[model samples]
Target: MKTAARKTRPAFLDAKRGVGNWAEATEWLRDRGIEDIECITPDLSGVPRGKMMPSSKFTSNTSLALPSAVFRQTISGEYPEETGDFRYDPLDGDLKLVPDLSTLSAVPWESDPTAQVICDIHNTKGEPVVYTPRNVLKRVMQLYTDNGWRPVVAPEIEFYLVAQHEDPDYPLKPPRGRSGRTITGGQSYSIAGVNEFDELVDDIYDFSEKQGLEIDTLIHEEGPAQLEINLRHGDPVELADQVFMFKRTLREAALKHGIYATFMAKPMQDAAGSAMHIHQSVVDARTGKNVFSNPDGTPSEAFFHFIGGMQQLIPKALVMMAPYVNSYRRLAPGMACPVNNAWGYDNRTTAFRIPNSDSAARRVENRLPSSDANPYLALAASLGCGWLGMTNKIAPGEPSYKTVNEGTTIDLPRGLLEAVSLLESEPDFARIFGQEFIHTYAGVKRGEFETFMRVISPWEREFLLLNV
Candidate 1:
């Protein structure tokens, strides 16, 4: 890969400073006649957690206050026992949510004309909250900035769109007439045969464009009713925002068309699973040069170190990458999912792949993560690993050239328990993700896993009923 000359852009040129302060935000709201605002913060599992507020109060208030204990709440809305009596006091204390003004946007698809703003959690004393996912990513970004590096990321998201059944008690409804039918056959990127879903795709594209989103491409994926959408590369924070918005937009668009969209990694037992493949690189902040470019235009040492860090931390970060119980079902070999921790050039079978492209376009593609991952956590984990590798000068092991589908000899954690155990024991994970946060996350996930284990499956009932 040959290094290409980098183009320069003025500093602060692209900064989104649409709403500078509460006063301006309020005036803007008044002009637009917007009456409601949603102050959203990403929780432990990357789900939005916050309250809807009257537009006047939301824009006029100097600072938005929330309970700090909301961070400690379980994804299912329960308090963890570890908090003991501390949780009650914290719930009563105020944690201010200062708006990230750049994130203010109107919900184009919402019928009631709502506005949204992403927030950074702060203690009542005005300091940044340590455990919040946004704060975690911000810390990681600061580390990169301190090292004179800027991370650029682009993510490819895969999801499924299914017709919403007419009745909850009835089986899934067949598509309306022959033209509006869903894909029953597993077609691997057949553009000609995918015209049946053109209406849905067109709607999605229109919706995304209306929201000022930059979606580069959309195509049919390997599974029936599965689709992949790719966004252009940008700064890590902006990329994560795009991911969050993309999921929301897809769901809203689907619902408008009388369909449902899911980002679940594996919805069907035998179907190909959805994945979120992330492409990443580092650039020099001063010169705007790509630091990952090698002298010969191949992947540079920085790039190798980044990939090495990802490989080292991947096993431990599985819980973050694939948070749900069903996420593991997509990791089987030969199914286009990564079952082993390996890297290769132009190889899709390996967990990490350097796609065959010109030096200017070279990037590492991490294929292990499912569509269910929280973008903030995923980016933080990747940055943490990269930071560690850079600081320690860790070299990556030799690349595995063997095809992953043929079952290369490398071993990966077999299940969620193994994944969680690996994460808990990783040396620097506690330092990157604070022990308190890690413990809380582990407890919540473990509870979910235990509940899943106690359930009797349909397969078990069918097999035992006749055999016994």
Candidate 2:
């Protein structure tokens, strides 16, 4: 294969293996009148867990250490006895929090002059924690780098703005618009719907600019009070970082406006599901040219194999794409969400969608992921699936254009238990992600499932309890 001309590596990636310039970062925050620092690292559940430190304590070589057990904790903060091996084996050990300096930015929404940075977890020996979602993604990127390929990804994440609810058991409603009336009607792509929240949109733009997140377009989705925002395409690592930070920023911005923003995959039973649809393309490491297209402007072999590889892995990789029990609810038979791995031209029915575009812009849109999945893990799984095909020259045959066509026989995992069972044992998946990560991630997932099953749902009481 002829390599593309050499392109410069993104600065953020260069620092992934090394610490960011902390000396200048400290002085930069001080110059901006930042007083406090929120140091955060993403846990297995994609939840941020860390401490807030005084700006005075911020140093060039600051080390934030915490127990490794935090990574094994379930979504509800419980540690399953089975998964607790990482919790307290002869007393829980510390993992060092190494901040990625490229992520440092001022927290614009906060009343206090504060800054925040995302960190990656490392063992006491300063080894990358393979189980950490961020580190896992980093390792996956290394696979592409080793092959002299770079992936460009842009994400369109959907979320909802709902009324504040103090109780978990209660259903959330759409918050009132500026007109004081709740946005109950499904106004998909309505400019009027967006105008109702101009203040919020403006605030989001201002906050994002201050935080270094390049947010692109905003749209009113099919669901009531739902907003879908697009991010500009760039390096996969930085794109993942932006998505993670953007989710938090939306919540903080919503709270300031007296509403709650949620990224739950299926927040409402009747509402359309929220998805984190990733648009991806590979570029030659040297030339920075799109690998999906040939010099003559035709579909390249890499493009075909990428789709073939994605189809091969979608069944097992769905767990990473849609990481929760609730996520399955979104993948219905006939809904907009994909339940099969079929690939087609601009088809929304398939998991792999090739949107109609020019040769230079040709890319695959993996629509399997929910808004709830961790960006780092989801992106890694997505790229790895395609990379597998590219390297092996996997051939995905004809595209389906009708219902009940090809790929219908391939039964996708319908629940979290089934997904995890597949993820734990899938050989190719473990190869792309490590065996250690598979074991650790599977343990955490099973713990969450077991805890979830213990709950008696409203449907159970409504049907099973009375009927029985």
The TM-score leader among the candidates is: 2
Candidate 1 lDDT, 154-196, residue by residue in tens: 9899987766755533333223413645566466677843566
TM-score of 2: 0.93
* Model 2, span 1-468: residue lDDT tens: 999999974454322122357666755766667789988988877888998988878764667987988887888998877643323445778898888877888788888998888888988887998888998898889989999999999999999999999987788899999999999757989999998899999999888887888989999999989999999999998899899889988999999999999999998888889999999999999999999999999999999999999988777888888888999888875445778778899777778889999999999999889999999999999999898999889999688786532343435898998998887766887778887788778888888888899998888888998688
TM-score of each model, paired residue for residue: 0.88, 0.93
Candidate 2 lowest-lDDT run of ten: 10-19
* Off by more than 4 A, model 1: 1-18, 73-93, 165-178, 192-194, 408-410, 465-468
lDDT of 1 at 160: 76
What clash pairs does model 2 have? 4-286, 4-287, 5-286, 5-287, 6-286
Which residues of candidate 2, in runs, are more than 4 Å off? Answer: 1-20, 83-89, 403-410
